[model samples]
Target chain A: MLFDYVYAVDMAHTAEHGARKAGTRKRADAERNIAAIITAAADSLARDPDASMTDIAKAAGLGRVTLYAHFPSREDLLRSVLAQTIAESTGIIEAVSPDEGQAAEAFARMIRSCWPLLSRFGSLHAAAQRALPAGEVRRRHDQPMAYVERIIARGRAEGAFRTDLPVEWLVTTVYTLLHAAADEAAAGRLATDAAGEILEKTLLAALKPE
Target chain B: MLFDYVYAVDMAHTAEHGARKAGTRKRADAERNIAAIITAAADSLARDPDASMTDIAKAAGLGRVTLYAHFPSREDLLRSVLAQTIAESTGIIEAVSPDEGQAAEAFARMIRSCWPLLSRFGSLHAAAQRALPAGEVRRRHDQPMAYVERIIARGRAEGAFRTDLPVEWLVTTVYTLLHAAADEAAAGRLATDAAGEILEKTLLAALKPE
Candidate 1:
C-alpha cells in the first residue's frame, strides 16, 4: 500500500514535469523521460530499504544499463535525490517570512510553515540520517539549532520564558520534543495537528516562569 | 569481526545446551556457553542493525536451522533478547521500594536504577519501536507506564507534585525524556550519567508546587 501511494505520487510528479516541458518546448522529451526515471528510482528506493539497482530501474520503466548511464551507482542516485530534496526543502525555509511578530511567535510561525515540507520529505530525511556520516548530519542540523537558540534567547530577554535553564538546554529540549512529535506523526500514532499541539504545549511548559 | 563474535557466542550456548542434555556432567559448561551466546548476540546487534542470522548461528556453534528452531525471525530473536534485558533492568525498579521513601528520593533512586538500562537498550528500543505493532508494544509497555503513573499519583497526593497536569501527561513527559536522554548518550553527545541528572532536574522542575 505504501509503495503504491509513493509510486502514484512519483508518476504525478513526472506528469507535471512533462506538461511543463511540453508547454515550454525548450527541452527534448528525453530530458523529461530522464526526470521521470530519477523520480521513479527515488520513489522505489524510499519504499524498499534494500531495493537493488535493477529493481529501481524496473520501477523507472528503463533498462538497468540506461539507469546506470543516468546514475553511475545506487549511492550516486541516492545522493543526487537527497541533494535535490534538501535543496527543495531549503527553499521552503527561505520562503517563510521569519520576522512576523515577537520572537516566540515568529519562531512558531516558521516551524508551522516548514511542517509540510518536513512531512513531504520525511523519507529523504530518514535516508540522509541513516546514510550520512554522523558529523555531516550534525553539521547540517546546526542551522536549525542556531535558529531555535536565538529565538529562545530572545524569549528569555523579553521575559516570555524563565531565565533559569540555559538557552542551549532549552533549545535541546524543544528540538527533542519536535523530533519526537515528528516521529509520532510519521508513524501515524498521532494526528499531525495533535503532534504540533503537543509540541507547542511542551515548549510553553518548559518556558513558563518558575 | 561482528559475525565472528556472534558465532563464538552461539557455539558456547550450544555447548551449554548439550551439557544440560547430558546427565549434569557439563552443566556448568553449558551455563557458561549460554551466557556467552547471549552476550555476543546483544553486543553485535547493538552495533549492526542488519546482523545476519547465519553469523549468529556460527557464533553460537549451532547450525542456522538450529538457531531458527530457537528464534523464528530476526524480530523474534531481537524481542527475546530485549525481554531478558528488560527483565534484568526491572530488578532495579523493584529494588527501589517506591513506597518506602520521600517522593523526591524515590524518584531519584528510580532514575538511577533505570538509567543504565535505558542507555544500553536505547538503539534496540528504537528499532523494536519501529518494527512492532503499536498495540503489541503498548501492551508490553503498560506495566512500566502503570508504575510511573502510580509514582506520579503518589507524589501528587503528597503535595510534592502539582495537580494541574494530568498523570498521563506526566508519564508521557518522563518517558520521552528518558528515551531522549538515552538517544543523546548513545549518540555520544552526552555522558550516560547526564541522563539521570537531567531527568531528575526536569522532573523536579515540572512537578514543583504551582
Candidate 2:
C-alpha cells in the first residue's frame, strides 16, 4: 500500500509537469503564428490592400482556423500589423545614433533608413486608414515622430538647423515631405533611392540658416 | 361661335404659358438647392468628417427629402463637396500671377493664396479619403498641383528656384509643405498666418540656389 501511494504521487507529478510543458509549447506556437501572420499580412496587404483573410492565411502558410484563432477579424489583424510596423519603425529610429555625427548627416541617415519602410507599406497605409479611426491612425503614425522630434531639437539647439520656424512646424514639415516622397516612389514616378536623395537635399537646404 | 372659339384658344395659350413659367421656376429652384447643398456640405464636412446627410440638409435649410433628391447618398454628397472644393481651389490658383513678379515673389504669392484652401478643407480631405477610391482621391488632389507645377518650372527656368532638383519634386515639396502647414493650423498648434509665414520662409530658403 505504501509503494502504491508513492507511485500514485509520482504519476500525478509527472502529469502536472507534462501539462505545463504542453502549455508552454502552445504559447510559443501562438507567438510564432502571430508574428508570421503579421509579417505575411503586411506583405500581402502592402501588395494589395484588398487582400482577403484567406489570402493572408495562405501567405502565412497557416490554416484558416489558426489564423482566425489568432486574429478574430480583419481589423484586429490590421491593428496588430500597424502596431508591428510602428514597433519596427521605432526600432529603426532607435538604432540610429542621432548624436554621433553632424545633425544633417544624422537626419539624412534617418531619412534613408526610414523611406524604404514607407515604400514597402504604402498600400497597407491606405488599408489602415480605411479600417482604423483617423485619430487612432494619427496616433500610431505619430509614434515614430518622437525620434524625429528629438533629432530636430538637437539640430536646432546646435545651430545645425534653422531657428526661424518653430521646431514643431519643422518636424511636421519633415514628416509631410517624407510621406510625399513615399507617395511619389510608390507611384513609380521616382525610385526609392532618388526620392530619399531628393528629400535629404531639399530638407537639408530648408534646414540651413537663411 | 367665332368669339367663343377665340376665347378658348386664348385660355389654352395662357395655361401653356403659365406651365412654362412654372417649369422655369422649378429648374431655377433646383439649381439653387444644389448650390446651397454643396456649399453647406463643404462647410459642415470641413468641420466634421462624420457630418450626416441630415445634418447637412439642416445646415442648408432644406428638407431631408430634397437633400436625398439631389444626393442619393452620403457618398454622393461628399463627391459633390469634393468637386466644388476642387473647382474653388483651381479658381484661387488661377488668380495667382505666377509670372508677373520675380519667380520667388510669385512663388510666395502662390503659397500664401493656396494655404487657406488647404486649411479650410483639412477635415474634408479625411472624409474624401474614406469615401472615395485611393486612385480617385489622388487624382482629385492632384488637380490643383498643375498651377504649382507651372510656377516651379518658371522658377527653375528663370534660375530663381534650384536647378539641382527635378521640377516635379520641387512642386510636390511645395504641395506637401502647404498641406503640413494647414494640418498644423487645423490642429491649433500654429496660427494660420504664422504657418503661412513659416512656409514661405522655409520653402524660399530651400528653393534658393545651393
Tell me, by lDDT, which candidate is best. Answer: 2
- Model 2, B123-143: lDDT tens digits are 777777767765576577676
Question: DockQ, per-model, please?
Answer: 0.11, 0.56
Per-candidate Cα RMSD to the true structure, in Å, reads: 13.4, 2.9
lDDT of model 1 at position B20: 76
List where candidate 2 sits over 4 angstroms from the true fold: A1-26, A49-58, A61-69, B1-15
**Tens-digit lDDT track for model 1 on A43-131?**
66454434577887888788888788777776677677766655665566556655345877866776676666555443444444445
Give the native contact fraction of candidate 2. 0.69
TM-score of chain B of each: 0.75, 0.88
Give TM-score values for chain A, per-prediction.
0.64, 0.87
Backbone collision count in every prediction?
13, 0
lDDT of 1 by residue, B18-115 (tens): 87778475666656655655665666555444456776677777677766766778678767666777677667787888666677678778888898
Cα error of candidate 2 at position A49, Å: 4.2
lDDT of 2: 0.82
The top-ranked prediction according to DockQ is 2
Lowest-sum lDDT 10-residue window in model 1 chain A:
A129-138
